[model samples]
Target: MRKALIVGIDYYSHITNLGGCVNDALAVRGVLERNADGTLNFPTPNVLIGTNDTQPVTKTELKSAVRELFVDDSDVALFYFAGHGYLEDTGGYLCTSDSVDGDDGLALSEVMTFANQSSAKNKVIILDSCHGGSAGSNAIARTMTEISDGVTILTASTATQYALETGDGSGVFTRLFVDALNGAAANLVGDITPGSVYAHIDQSLGTWAQRPVFKTNVKKFVSLRKVDPPIALADLQALTTHFPTADHDFLLDPAYEPERSPGQENDPSIPPPDPEKNAIFQVLQKYVRVNLVRPVDAPHMWHAAMGSKSCELTVLGQHYWKLVSEGLI
Candidate 1:
């Protein structure tokens, strides 16, 4: 089970009510629930969201939610908070709606304590709000800061910087964060993790802007989401549309008639097309290597002499086609 405690506070009795915190929380939940490729990475049911717009996220409720999320030994625990954060001598604090003075907030040190005690092998915590950068640090003394092994913490900004948001209810950090998950943060191995996401977002922001903070003890990355293929949806659709069922064999040599085998994805013959080779095959080869298409049926003659020749859409290809044809992606 992958469990998330998503808390977004927009209403406060004494402080200025933020316009974007709730929206920020929803955006994170949406992306984690389903990646841009429409794959269900985190289900809705497993994500527990508490918003001040509907239900108040009191300090008690926040603590309970945070504690409950880490209870399951088999779960991958994720905690995300988007709201007002405060800096005090104790540490960073995640503010709740009921918080009036700076003291009435969830202490960051306490939150980290819960995170450290979690039984989950993979624990991730994300704080998106002002003063979020203060997390995992002691404000008063030059004490050594530390986190338990297997814990990954990503904050919207360094402890001293404010996580900026627009009046339009969008977080600058989160906007880039979501974009990073949608292929921007993908590494050479085609996997995106918290560390990569922080690096991507941090680099994209200007030097004066908030810098995302990432701390990890785990050597191996745990994939929270899978990015879309490098090719754009429109490009993939353009390629798919090139090979209509009724269309003539566009790529294969006219002499290789009966047998059809698409060669190895990188089969020297496949590259960005020029007049020398058919343009359609170039697209097919790119997408095939990315696992969007495959040889549809057994080959007879036209199939690559020994490999494959003509191609068919794989299940993933069909899914992307549906998304593209309908302009969903």
Candidate 2:
């Protein structure tokens, strides 16, 4: 069983309410639920979300969820928290909606304790809040260095810096994190793991802005997702000869053939209509989406409007065309 507890808080009457934390949490969960190959990773049922619906995450509820996640020895437990984190001399406290009085929210150290006590074969904790790195800096983490070989901790930033939220309704750290899971961090074999994800985020974000923290005892990484690249080299190569010339528009739809004269056709440049070629062209048309991977650039984009010239090939289309021509995908 692969279980995940995703937490994000936007409603905090005590502290400043964050705008993108909830969105960021959902994005991470969404990416984790599926791989780039369109295969399911951790399904919706295995992933628990904590937000306004389950918000004001009291210490008890958070603790219970953490306990439930790691109860099974064979399960892979992953926890992610994106909210405010307050640090004191004692420990770091991740602020929940219920935390009203002081920084007395759910203690991250205790959270680590729950994670450490887990019987899970693999346990991963990702902290996306402010000063979340403090959890690994505590006495327990320092003293008990070899508690478990499968435990991995990934923090958004160092003990002092705040995790930034983007204008696009996602934390900057989480956006790249999700992107890595989706495809960015994938190896040539399509496997994407925690280590690769960390590398992706680390390289993307400079050390001065935010320094992500990582502590892992596992030798082999557990894969989170697989990235399957589209656009087959064979498919692209097969499309070459039919491509449009520099001055001629490749007719997208055979039905859009201009009225042909009976005696003789004036345009030798245009290929005469043929049923066999039209069938293959129609089948190939499936690759061209409007404005995305269109073969033509101008009018009559989809279904061939009356005046729509052969839709021009997009930049991406041209790139693939070149690659195919050069025997590269």
Candidate 3:
């Protein structure tokens, strides 16, 4: 089972209210609740958005929710917080609506403790507020941080930086995060992991901008979502079958050129096109489109075929071929 506790506090009585935290929470909930194929990824997330005329998001309330979220033994437990993050001589705190001068809200250390002690197989903590990068760090020591096994932390910015908000009522980090979940961070086989999400966000942001932080202690990454693969599974698996060896080149002739097939402009000078070869050529063309196959001694596949040249697997194609040979695809 997968559970998520998503908190967005936009209404703070003692501090400047934020306009986009609630929106960021709602957007995150949308993506986490469903995968790209419209299948359930996680159960409906426990969402708490602070707004006027409703119960305020106090430190106690947020802490209680987080504790409950991590108390159970489950496959995955995820906690997301978007609000004001206060950092002082002690440590970072996820500010609540009841935050005051000296005290903010729940301490980042406290949150990390809950995650570290969780019974869940995988625990993910995502913070989109300022100083969020301080989540897994030691408050007093500053140099020593202990992240237990299976815990992953992704924060929007470094401890000293501020996460930006767009004029469109969305957090800048979250906008890219939503895009990443929507398949921007997916691998060739469509798996989107927390590490990939961090990479996507990091690359999308300017070097001079706020940097996203990623800390994890897991043996293997868990797929947060899946999208349609760039190439069909069957086609991917056939890489080894077609290449035989990674460096092996597949010879081509005029029969492999669909344009040279019968009923089209006939190249009388060349041999008649074979239907079987043409069918194989179609699959090879698909590989060419994705840069897995490249013509050798010719500029294009068509030229390779017409000139009786050959095509070989690209470096990337060889990698996939190795995976296929090992039955890893």
Writing each residue's lDDT as its tens digit, candidate 2 over 166-209 gives: 78778888988988887888754467888999999999987578
Q: lDDT (CA) for every model shown?
A: 0.71, 0.70, 0.89
What would the per-residue lDDT of candidate 1 be over residues 126-189, giving only the tens digit for each residue? 8887777666665555245567877888988877788888557778887887787677897433
Name the better of 1 and 3 by lDDT: 3
- Model 3 ranges with Cα > 4 A deviation: 260-264
The 10 consecutive residues of candidate 2 with the worst lDDT sum are 299-308
Q: Model 1 scores what on Cα lDDT?
A: 0.71
Give the lDDT of residue 172 in candidate 1.
84
Residue 218, model 2: Cα distance from true site in angstroms:
0.9
The best-first sequence of candidates by TM-score reads: 3, 1, 2
TM-score of each: 0.68, 0.65, 0.93
Instruction: State the TM-score for model 3.
Output: 0.93
Q: How accurate locally is residue 18 in candidate 2, as Cα lDDT from 0 to 100? A: 78
Estimate the overall C-alpha local distance difference test score of candidate 2. 0.70
